[model samples]
Target: MGASFCSPVDERCTCSLQSTIHAFRFPLWAVKVSDFLEMLGPPRPHHRLQEEGLLHEWFPGMFVIFTSHQWLSSTHPDPQGQQMEVLQKALRGMIDGSLQVHEDLVARSDRMNLSNTIRQHIAEGFLFFDWFAIPQITVRKDGVNEESVKSAAALAVQSIPAYVELSNVFIALVPELTHKDSSALVNYASWLSRGWCRAELWCRLLSNKIDTTVIVIHSPTQAEFMFPLDWQHNSIVNGNFTVESDRAIVVQLGETAVESKIQHLQVHGPLRDCRFYCALRPKLLCQERADRTLQKFLEDFRFGSLEQAVKDTSGMNAVMCAILSGDTGMLRLLAESRADVSRPMHGLNDLGYYDTQTPLMAATKSHQDPAVLTTLVELRADPNGRASNTKLSSLYMCRSAGHVRALLEQRAELEHAALHGAAALAGPDTLRELLSRQCDPNHILAGRQERFGPLHAVALFSLSNRHAVEAAKLLLEHRADVNSRSSPSDEFLWECRKARMRVVVLGFANCNMMTRLRASMSGISPLGYAALVGHGQLTQLFLDYGADPTPNDRGDTPEDLARRNHHYHLIPMLATFAT
Candidate 1:
């Protein structure tokens, strides 16, 4: 078992040329899940595993689980064996059918389940963790044979994509933990921003495997299929790399992976997916847009003619293509050719754009150029159009001050919705613009049952935005209440009950599930909302501004919310404030 090697010439090996060469040099290494679970005190180094005769070379039909994670310490992946403990328990629960992976919260309606086949695979699987598979010279600097070590390390580094492609399952181990050196909170958001992590993600998602589901293990008890839009938002070119020079190489790898995916989809006859990828190719590659003639545009996007393109209102229709490609001229041409600029988006819910999103809304949410928004408005796009599903206007999706100005210039309303939206989704510049226009930072919707304000909006929806902290600070500076509370009315409770029934129907029940539901449906403070989502920075910010650690209407305090969600790292901080 330990001496086997998967043949690089196998028909299943469809890695790129560069990846193949590197893989051929180093081959893939893994350790059986059963063996790994038994021999763990602290995370053992690769050499230690090898010396114990535990490491195994990959072979055909072997079930491989590729684990991607961030290092918590400078010299070790997990100095306290915290991550390994979680993995161990998760694996145990999975094998015993105690743990069930579900879809993310946004897509809970899909009710994607962890198949019994995957559970069986986990029972007899091998894990390909970086620290356990690759040689670690960077941490062990005093080792002998420096030159030989460098050669082997380089080979393993370059072969990562091949290993990713070969794996049967991809698990992102992104438990919220604090970085020992930088004290930064490392979680799903930070993991998504990493360049190498993105590269690996693209490789696995783009692979020719039948099942490309990415299981994101947030905690031992909280694992879900990754949201598709998470990868689309975190482009490899925009990822952060510890060594800046690795950016170019990793970006090239990303391009190859995307191109490979597109080709595979083209042959596989998922024509809708093929068209979507073709339309998003340039944006994904971060390439400069070149002027395209009408015929060239039609051909590049695989449209039969302008009529077909204009009439289609699917996720990647002609209007969407133009918006995503940054082709404003083409956008005007489409509108002139009878394309509905305000046509609600369809079939893109998986990508997070949501249904009923108009072209202007899409452009705004995507952080497209200000010129694109101006052009859409000039082309008679609805300046105040709202998504039918969420009732959020395009103004609420403004990513910058330019977007706000463009909409306002077209007579878009500057109401409480705009301030709330900007507070949760936009940066300081956009908030500044709205505040200058005299939008009330503390205004609650008149005659509305939900008491959600701008501050509450910031707490609930700004988890993924890098500028959220700054946006919250700006709102506070503009006299927004630091201790704003959200008190849902009877109507709101009815709505929550309906949603809760849906969750119950989906078989999503746990020990404290009712308590959590009650707390969420009842009134909650901004600090409570922050703790609920485990936004460490936002919680700290709210505490610094004198936010009270009071319980909600359901008698669940901020600390309770944090613990219910398995945000253990936040317990200490919230406890300090509670005391």
Candidate 2:
């Protein structure tokens, strides 16, 4: 079969070149919403504003709405004209109490009601729109006001975070429009990926508001209130378009917001939103999202129900939450309340989602505090619990040698597959600890088939990880078998032989010979894999440690494989020992 092609709509592989190129065109100046409502004549054209570099100031408590679109080039009545009608209706609903503001954000008591705050601002109807308000300079000209305009625009872009913070309400206007490629212009997935849209989104989320809700307008008639935490499932923040200073601002904003203990419980009934929020944004800037603050704070508080305590959007119960946040006290409370010790949390965040874990599994992976781990083990949580997707146990996710020892104290499985995962992910110290514990250094993942050993795992790890050499050195020092072969099953050999026969019958003998021969080979040693992937250092390391350069079941030596794969530099080194 032919290889499958990636479609433009495939989010994982394809990004819009048009959207990426135009992300820098942020509106520098905007007119007040009230000004737009009171305009008597056709307002001065964009050309005039571009020439003058003049703009009106936005007041505190003003409503700000951003649209992910360029100015209309057509003379026809624009579809965005309908957005004004929708905003007006929403405003009316907020004022009359017909529509509910975020239930969690609205005060339960008489003091500091967010609903009232929203109503007061809706009454003013003052808004900040980029196109109607911000001066748009299409091009630069030789004049005094030209530099002034550029400077003003620069300042406005720089102050976007502050602008979003000051605005009482934020709206994302994404109406469906036809693209030149026959695709919809205002898709939530597409709009969310744009650098400028993400910048606006982060500005609002990281703003000082304790309970921020973004209004997303999908069409002229429909709109929805989106939880800011929902966007954390992906990279919703723009890393580019803005400068390093701006990126730093976003990081600080996330840190500060996380510290406030995200108020998601008030917005959504169950702690699911909060659970999802915490899971997605834990402990890294660009690599992950943020830290765990909200879950840690709940230790001092009481929940109304077990459902509230148990229901996590990402499948984490209060027990797992406590363990993940390193809150020993919270863990004790949940355990005492008869919370299921073996409950699996399916993390929805970008980091830990694939590896759904039991409370024990979460603690084991975090390698945070031994007290937290000891408490879970005392509570009878399973140390050998596996994630639903990855099928990896707690012992496989140990962060360091100390963590491995701690899990070992709790009686974690010390088998070959488990050791393989540990060697692949952990540093040299962790590997040494496992080896010292009498865990076989040359152990293979499978029994009869002999899938892979420590050196093979080390070879794969070296491709991406910086400490591959050190890890290899550690395994070598532990006397891991350098030339241990990973044997394939008889079933695989039969399938390969059959496929090779078919290829030869079809008159493509040479084309499929090498591929089928490699496939038919019963086993490959550490040096074989090293030569296959073209890691010269790792191959040399194996050779220095006395690896066998002998051929496998298919009569192909390490040198022959490297030469076949066009690794000319490795041929000389392999030739040093190859007969």
Candidate 3:
């Protein structure tokens, strides 16, 4: 593919011999701003400017950089002056081998192995930022004007995916920012809310590769890394500013992700049912999988065996489809062919996906009949496989469907994740079974706290009165710690604050009228969160169990949180246990 200044978008510009695009050469060892901007040969070297289509194939070592609009300082001579300063500092640190820009916090908890990939990219790679790489006529020295480069710039926008695909890592330079508009833009939420930003994110996540890395730079020292699954829940739902065109692009992106592994659609959250809509979209768009049909699926799919098929293809198998769709005749036919019942699936059913899970996990998520689970268990299918990716178990997935009993009977491991998940999601009977099986009601697990007991888990998920009352009663009966020194969920509370900011930005007549907000919800207890969320009965229960109503690490009492959130009714009850 010879470099052709092909004008797919403009008529004025031709592949004129005189026209040349510029790409800065920055060695990973020592990055000097001056050296990076020096004029190269007349024609652009090995690197393809964003104007050239399918650049990722040519420049597979480039970095797909992401940042907030705040980085574009309007007051600076160059809008990207601040961003360039930060990048220069980062490059210098990398050269000195002194700075390890921390990967996103969520990546640390994921199984994607993203941290290592980012480390490699930072140690040796190139940059593909549009601001510097794509020549702006106004900034160019060759007497080029905006009109002269209009077609190329337009083509550059169309080549974003190629740029992203070729890149080694997606670096999001997100600082804690407060923009003037705040309309779909505030801090990390700001980058997440933008349509183009999401398109870039999707390009990386829904790519043809596995274990992709996304680096988040909160500050020069506080850079974090994350994987696609870590951000799927928020990314799928937080599109308040997305237009119809963006939605169409998102649907195409999602289809590509799903085609890689159908279970990719299982990730969802509590925002506007967008996850469901996004998943169902490919079907309406008539998007077909790569293999086209079931027979072709089996013929072309590569894996070790039936078990590996479930693991690799994520239950996109014809036999699994039959089992999931309740086609008993088809299932029987497959069974007659010596189908393995112990095969674990990594796919999505109606409810969710269970990564590294057995057929029992599938039956559990799909809410299949008790008979289905029984057949698998009787066939010696292991119920020991946990849903590692989801951080929840097949047993936990079965909670809302009341299938916990069957799993308990089959002896699923009553581990910390299982117990904690049950604490948040299961009923009294499920909790009783778990406790009877030697699952500790006071088991310490990572959540809001580094190691919170089951009671703390219950406090966060107690939205319904029946769930709150019965589950709390069961835990307390089993000697649950009401005054457990659990750390409050600053992460969740911060997200709440971001949601509030979005409300203020889009709701208020003038966003500037809103006062500056604080970001420290650091030390809330079970009682404090309960009070803040306005759960009066749960507060009384905590008080009954002798939970101290004194001030927490942040010096705010349950009474204070209750008053702040306007749950005045809980104040009298909480005041009874006064500090």
Candidate 4:
């Protein structure tokens, strides 16, 4: 029989046929929070949980928490029960209002919080952990009833997305842990790279749930709402899998999720969101680009006419659509019809392209062709324009040497901030172009309170860039200081306090206290920034270059920052290089 299909808008629809089979063959099992707390000693298997009468059938409004994580071993997900301990402490903290779910450092503006209502629900919730929910028959040596056991295991695996959709909260239990067999550091980064984890993430984010926020638990005391850009950058098609054969199946699942999300939004009446999803559908699916005619484009984007498209200045306006679609001719046509080439973006923050960013900035960040940048400039888009929210020039968003050249040719000002931005966001080619223009690698902004150099910028902002190491190396080769410290002005601290007070006044949780405290403090060296983010390769590179591990103004050394952030894997390395 062909694969069973279901409407994405259906609240009770299962996306896959295997998940439907799973309903009868292997039901989704969960454990109550109170009962889970009572389980003593090592982590138990599904059979033991069922035997102990701890497993319960998940039902509507049961407040199920679906956990996504990386396996620590081939046979066991948590060989040492370390992850379980962290989860237990975190849950207890949530129930008692001790553990505050903070926003990620980069997502302070999102104002994410775990409300008391949700906390109450979590206090009376059930957990769907794969180890405790799925049959662990594959690890058994005996082959008795092996086919039935294998079938059950496969069905459970396929039903994971359905379970995720049924849950109220999604938690990524990514506390820094060591892999048993490979001795690899299994943490947030490693978990993000796993194929199965990405599938679970897509399932939840693309689900029809009203609140699809993912809580990433880094340590017992530290948890944050995930930055949307993380999932957007790490597509399931690019995720690593233990078995290569699983790639095809998982990729298919991802396509279904994406399609379902787009269809649901299209039918649902948030026209702006529908347009955003439709425009990004190709990129999300990893499909080859197929150029569309202007007629087809307007129809697909739900525009009544070309005039309607041109007059709009929303997030996915005519100019933005043309830029994303890679149609330079359409961009020119829109400009000719009085479309504001310099209009700031709005209502697209969920996709990581923030508000107040110009079309030039979006094009630069999206790494569009150099020709696209040239076309925008030729159409009178300001090359030196800065985002109103961030005060960052379009030059700061350049991804490649060509982008820099395109902006520079239009007289985009090359200053210290440009070098800092290039080191953090761009590749080696872009950094090389900026340095060749004699941009100082260690030039601290004289007036700004956040006077950070190029090296410091790389450490703080280059988390997702694969070219971060090479970009940093380029700066170091240009004589950037390995131990240059940040000098936050007193005004910076005052402003931070004001911002915190504003958050309090607005009745939002102060989820950025840690980040604010770090920012207000002065004399944080480049090494400290790297260690704060647990960038192993960059930290080692700084150590190899003789970076001093001396404590900063707050008396927190690089090792202290690493340990505080639960980067235990970096402890030995930092200790060996400690001054």
Candidate 4 on 1-579: residue-level lDDT in tens? 000111124322221222211123358899998887776655788877887889999765566888898888888888778888888988887777767776666644424456666677788889999988988886533554878777888898888978887777789998766789998867777788888899999888887654567888876666777777678767899999999999999998888888887778878747776776676677677777676787988988888999999887667887888787666888888889898999888877766688888889888776677888999999999998888876788887887889988888887787767877778767789889888888888988554567778898888754555667788888888899998888776667565556545545642223343543353346788889888776777888898888998776666788987876666767998998654
Candidate 2 lDDT over 204-272, as tens digits, reads 654434334566553322334543323443343443432445556555644544433355344443455
RMSD of 2: 17.7
- Candidate 1 per-residue lDDT, tens place, 190-276, comes to 888899999999888777664566887866666667767668767899999999999999999998888887887878846666776
Mind giving the per-residue lDDT tens digits that candidate 3 earns over 1-579? 000111123211111111111121221111223343332422232223424422232332233333323323322222324444545555554444433443223222211122333434444445555553443444444555667566555555555655555554466665432333322223344566555666567666554333234665533333344423233433432444435556665555545544533334333222212233333333323433121233433333333444444433334453455444433443444455666665656434212344456666666544455555655665566666554444455665555334666666788755655666666655676677677767777776653333467776676545422366678878888888777755435465555366346535653211111111111134556787677545656677888887887565556677876665445557788877664
Residue 90, candidate 3: C-alpha displacement in angstroms? 5.4
Return the TM-score for each candidate structure: 0.87, 0.50, 0.46, 0.87
Ordered from best to worst lDDT, the candidate numbers read: 1, 4, 2, 3
Q: Rate the local accuracy (lDDT) of all candidates.
A: 0.76, 0.53, 0.48, 0.76
Q: Which ten residues in a row have the lowest lDDT in candidate 2?
A: 103-112
Model 2 CA lDDT for position 132: 48
Tell how far residue 68 is off in model 4, in angstroms: 1.2
Query: How do all the candidates rank in terms of TM-score, highest first?
Result: 1, 4, 2, 3
